[model samples]
Target: MSYASIGKRLLGLAAIGLLTAGLSGPAFAQKTIKIGNVEPLSGPSASVGVQGKQAREMAVEEINKNGGIKSLGGAKLELVYADSKSDPTVGVTETERLINTEKVQLMTGCWNSAVTYPATQVAERYGVPFVVPVAVRDTITERGFKYVFRIAAKDSWWVRDQFRFLKDMQDETGVKLKTMALVFENGDWGTGFAEKWRALAKKDGYELVLDEPYPSTASDLTPVVTKLKAANPDIVMLVSNAADAILITNTMAEMKVKPKVTVASGGGHADPKFLENAGKNALYLFDEVEWNTDVNKPGAKETNAAFKAKYGYDLTGESVDAYVAMYVIADALERAASTDPEKVRAALAATKLSTGPAMICSYDSIEFDESGQNKNAGIVIVQVADVNGQLDRVTVWPKNARRAGYTPVFPANK
Candidate 1:
């Protein structure tokens, strides 16, 4: 072979080798950012948690499709989920694992407050930013943790929305309000809920008829039902999780002691599966939610459709909020110029971002006061409207209710 030909062949070989390495770059060299989660995967709250996972995955999927987090310089997202199984200890253990083993810098959250309370403490101890999506209890933030930030409004917001709706119900229906009976499951979510509801009942000039907390694992609440029925209140409300909501509704059906209205405060619509299972019995069942963009002014339908197309299901607030929250965190991470705990906290505190279904001010200016609570947050009010396949979920009260937020009915002082 000619010397010139040999030189050309060697040059071609070198070019080919360089091209191969460049082509294999992302597969071998891309950075992976791990985001941790501990949520119910096997218990009654599983539906809610699963939906959140789906939504978060969908968001990460979409973002990755668009070249991933800008600051990560194309690093892909990795979500590590620990099925908490609706247990607090499991949640704590998962948090520890995520922090120590996985070395994840951020966490989404567990859906149940029982799970969230303990999991949040772990985040506090580790100084990881936990972006809470749907769990309510104000205590999550009351502990003064710097790393904990709840985009989802707390229980106080929902309780307040319920009061506003109750007042409106009286004004609209002309039903003179008299008695209120509060029922809830025995858990963190239930504990905070019952306390807030009782306080509201006192402030609203309503006689407290039945105030009770039943075991969350109770198979049959017939005994609780009997006592609540005996009170004979003009109105009844449950501040329990999804399972209890279904059970209470079923028991109410069995006892045939229908009150003027039955409401499920915050835990009412956590899962679409439960809502579907509740069936006709769930009709007129009022629920307070932290996010739902149905009544949103604009862009909500597009975002909801995008999520539906990605996940192959109708998106609820739980999923939508988490998906948006990921973006919120990502945005803040970019804005603050660093993911350091303190810097991230400061950016989150100064967040005035907006999302698709931000009826609860998820899109408004997000500034946490010293208490770490977003002041401009709102909630969505959803009423199960199925009268045996005749009607679907309907929004009756606030013509423009966006956040399913609770209107104030408590702490007459506030």
Candidate 2:
């Protein structure tokens, strides 16, 4: 070949070499997979939102520390956050921004059911995978959306277990509960629980002395408490957000509106701030949760201890769900071996995560049903009691999972 021809051929070969290197470089270089999180970090539900954010941060740190997404060239998971302020409209807009602007591959959160309901719809419209950690409205997963997956038990399941616990405790303690009062925040989450509570109470032949719904952002719940006092219910069931929970609990104590049994449907009741703010007034209050500090699962205590050390408070049920969600996302990305939304969705759909750090959940396995709901998700009832001289949430129901030496104080008001 002539010198000119040889030079041209060499140039072509060099071009091909550069193209190949460009293709293979990304395969070797560390990459980041952005997971968008839309949470209520500013408004009424800020406490729960902050808890979820912290939990996700802790989980991502652990995953990165342990070698992130080994299937994706050790790509680390990066959480991108947008504060929904517990508003549905803000949640929808933030989700769009995360997907279109931030280029996140997956999505999670918006703790309030009002926010999560519409937020998941936006994710569904975009064909992005959304993993919901603890929005308990039943209809969230019931919309036939393939991209949405929830890790916590829905409100119906929560209500079912609440009634079951009441029956089981009644059977064990031989103290009957007849009239029930249903007081919940006027939101998607609270209304969902109230609907189920009504159906279950009627079926169980319990009279509903009061059915009241108040705004979560109400500056004063004294009126609600006063109504509850007048109702004089044997069992008082409450569904509230953080601020409202504290207000109602303290107001009840101030008014001395003690019922035979007071039950709370997690949410604000499970918030650490509620216990801290309500103090002894919240004692003997039965609340439903996905997991507790004293749970029987492996890694439960250690993980909670680590979280408490880091955040200055123990992990709540809402936070634990968010923590486990990171592991589930990592597991999905590992199985999918790619960051493609469809691949990640498929992997999430086929997930059967029964082991690893995520097993700290009360359920043995994490599997999604046709509706994208965690089929094995379970709930537990815990009573706020004095443990070691400090108010602590002690698991009490399900007989088998009750704390080793603590018997629940049923009929809290005698």
Candidate that would win on lDDT: 2
Instruction: Please provide, for model 2 over 1-414, each residue's C-alpha lDDT reduced to its tens digit, 9 standing for 90 to 100.
Output: 799999999999999999998998677657989999999899888888999999999999999999999988899999999999988889999999999998999999988999899999999999999999999899999999999999999889899999999999999999999999999999998889999999999999899999999998888889999999999999999999989999999999999999999999998999989988999999999999998888888899899889989999998888989999999999999999999899999999999999998989998999999999999998889999998898989999888988999999988988
Q: Lowest summed-lDDT stretch of 10 residues in model 1?
A: 405-414
Writing each residue's lDDT as its tens digit, candidate 1 over 269-297 gives 54566566667666666776655545454
For all predicted structures, in order, the TM-scores are 0.84, 0.92
RMSD of each: 9.3, 9.1
The per-residue C-alpha lDDT of model 2 at residue 409 equals 96
- Model 2 residue runs over 4 Å out of place are 1-29
